[model samples]
Target: MLPFVLSAALLEVVPSGKVPSSIPTASSTATIPTVMITRGQEQTVTPDWSRLSFANLPAITQSGSLNGQKWSAGQPVEKLLTLGDFQDSFKLQDLNLYAIAVATQMPIKLVKLSQFKLLAGQTLADLALAVPELEQLPVSTVKPLSDLLKSAKPSYRLTEKTLPQLLEQDPTLGALSFQNFDLTGYTLDKLPGLIHAPLQAFRHWQEAKLTDIPGLREMPWQQFPNPPSDSSMSGVIQLPTTMSYRLGKDSTSISGSSALGYQIPCAGCTSITFSDPPALQKKRWISGLAQWVQGGISDVAQSTTHSEPTGRNVFGKAFKVVVTEVSPKQAQTALYFRFCQFQQQISCSPYAIGPVPFLSYRNGELMPVGNLEIGTDRSITPQMLPSVKQILPTIPTEIPSTVNHWSELLSQILEQIKALLHPPATPTA
Candidate 1:
């Protein structure tokens, strides 16, 4: 969704020593908002870079500029262009600025997004004030820019009611991809006739059923649809009934179904994995296909990972954790578990359950260790060596149907166990 800085190898816990206040406690997921510390940070950021055609472009340092504007790292884009500009313009930079430039009949430079807020009657006329070069353009030349800012009844939601009206005013809007459309969540009664439909359009829209869209057929499970063009809207989009993914012809693959009985994007998370890059590299590819779930599209999905154990060892072993997610018919039994040998990343697959291990700070990095043993009373104990037969059956793996509750429970337990494993050293006398 956003660019991530692969600032370090892994997040290491300071074992019973003087810990910097800036570093979070072993139990505290209260993460620093910094991009480098989060899990799958590099994975999250990779898709954005793919939008750029020119490789070897210098990084966006604090001193970077866009079209000669003094844009710096973390600068609020609104200071240069409205959200409308972002959604309509900058969002499509990879396509080159030609279409919008011609539409406005003025110089089309980079810009940034507006939301349903624009459905409230916002226009792009104020753009001249944001970009100094546009100040001298005639109102006539900029008329198309304003025309591009379409609006509907402020009262209309993104539903069957709103779609026809927007199309009635400008049917071409339907041709716009999901990324160009600002609003989401509601499903139209039918697919727009003019939609530039994909062979597998179901993978892109939320709440879409095969019956609702014309000229489509059932997608085979062997195919991995391309990642969604606008993954930022993932957290809000609907998924299909089944999906699958693979990075290459030979990579480890995964497939999942909605009939298994649990919701998707549970707690704004689906799956994660770990990997160790070469010692001198500054960035690494996140090693899982579920990162595609970063866009929140597709149902009946499958994910894949590297088959080999490819990361530094912890506790004399290298391994990876695969969290298998299923679709919801009912609330219980959301995801199952599998233990893949450790590699450089995490992945979510489908089917099966076993002991899910926890990570510990090792050699100045956080590494997955033995499983956390579960008690009959559901108490959790950290085990230096996992006893799968004894621990697996005891796992209260009956994850709650509600996402927030499950997230909260896991957060609380993880913090408690981490605190126990690496207690803060007592203050010096």
Candidate 2:
């Protein structure tokens, strides 16, 4: 074994170390490769700070780890690395250099991820390249690579038999939007593990369960021994369940078993993004969404004004529409009706037969409204006193001036007449 002086102590401002003194001893050209560090019997100290090419990288070789100290390239490796396709260990910080787009053009490849073996005292974070440009990796290396990265996707297209074990190590991996990935659909077999995992990335992965992946509804799911708490599953804006034993299922729809049901991601996807800085931002979004569903739309509807209602043909001079805030019960019922409408529209469930409401689009969704949104979030901008007279469903309310469905009103009147005409037959005596 030979001991060599590290290059950190050298000041090589003079292009490649090939030229000595204040001037050159060799032709200075960009194509000429400069070796940053040397190993073996040759005691050479060459340092050049000029345009480097991948043609000549560090002089360290695979056989140079003879001392068993896990010797990596010398300090000058950084100057050479920008040239691309490096094949050696790097300080944890330098790992990100591989992401520099210009550097990868060189024929040299980044570290061989397959043969990647950890050196003692080095954690995966040390080799974790934040912006990895590689597309695929060996299956066995996937976990280690996941540990190294704590995430993969958007940068790399990953696929595996399972949902990346790195998910158990760090659920944030699901936060990334993969360009394309061949992964397993969510299953009851895996859900419990994710529910109990400590990492939020696992929870995020669970959130992705809200997706309508094929065959997921058919998976056999029963209450787990350790079901996730409300806090764990809250950020999940919507989830699909063919299982009746869910956290807070609509029991009416869950007869002895669950009828198919699914909720989508929140209206604003940014709240669910993994890149969100605040850990609880996702949770806050769920809370806000629940409030919206429960008719606590907050200040998004305060700008309504002007009450001269006009509609003679369909509505006639029957009623005057008044602007008012929706109560929690009204909001909940509206969402329920909307959900039923969506279910029927998709042809996915058994709908409770009821008269459908006429609809309008106030915020992003179409629901029953009279020139206003029933339950919109704080993010919506309020509308002004424009003459926007949109038609609405025949509302069933106690409001004195409101109109009722003619057919329903006729049925009520007929029942009243029958009761008056046929008083209970005189009690027999």
TM-score of every model? 0.17, 0.17
What TM-score number comes out for model 1? 0.17
Q: Report the error of model 2 at residue 67, Å.
A: 67
Considering summed lDDT, which 10 consecutive residues are worst modelled in model 1? 306-315
What's the C-alpha lDDT at position 163 in model 2?
Answer: 38
Measured with C-alpha atoms, the lDDT of residue 39 in candidate 2 is 26
Q: Compute the lDDT of residue 158 as modeled in candidate 2.
A: 49
- Model 1 CA deviation exceeding 4 Å by range: 1-125, 129-133, 140-429
lDDT of 1 by residue, 1-429 (tens): 112111122111122222212211223211111121223322211112222211111211122222223334323222223211212112221221222223233221222222112211212222222223333343223323322333322333343223334445555444433334443332221112112222122222212222222211111111112222332223322212112221221122121111111111111122222234322121111211222111100121122210111111111111122222212211001111122211232222221211111221222232221111111111112232123222112224344558797566555545543422211112121
Task: Tell me model 1's lDDT, rounded to 2 decimals.
Answer: 0.23
lDDT over C-alpha atoms for residue 170 of model 2: 57
RMSD of each: 23.9, 34.0
Candidate closest to the true structure, highest lDDT: 1
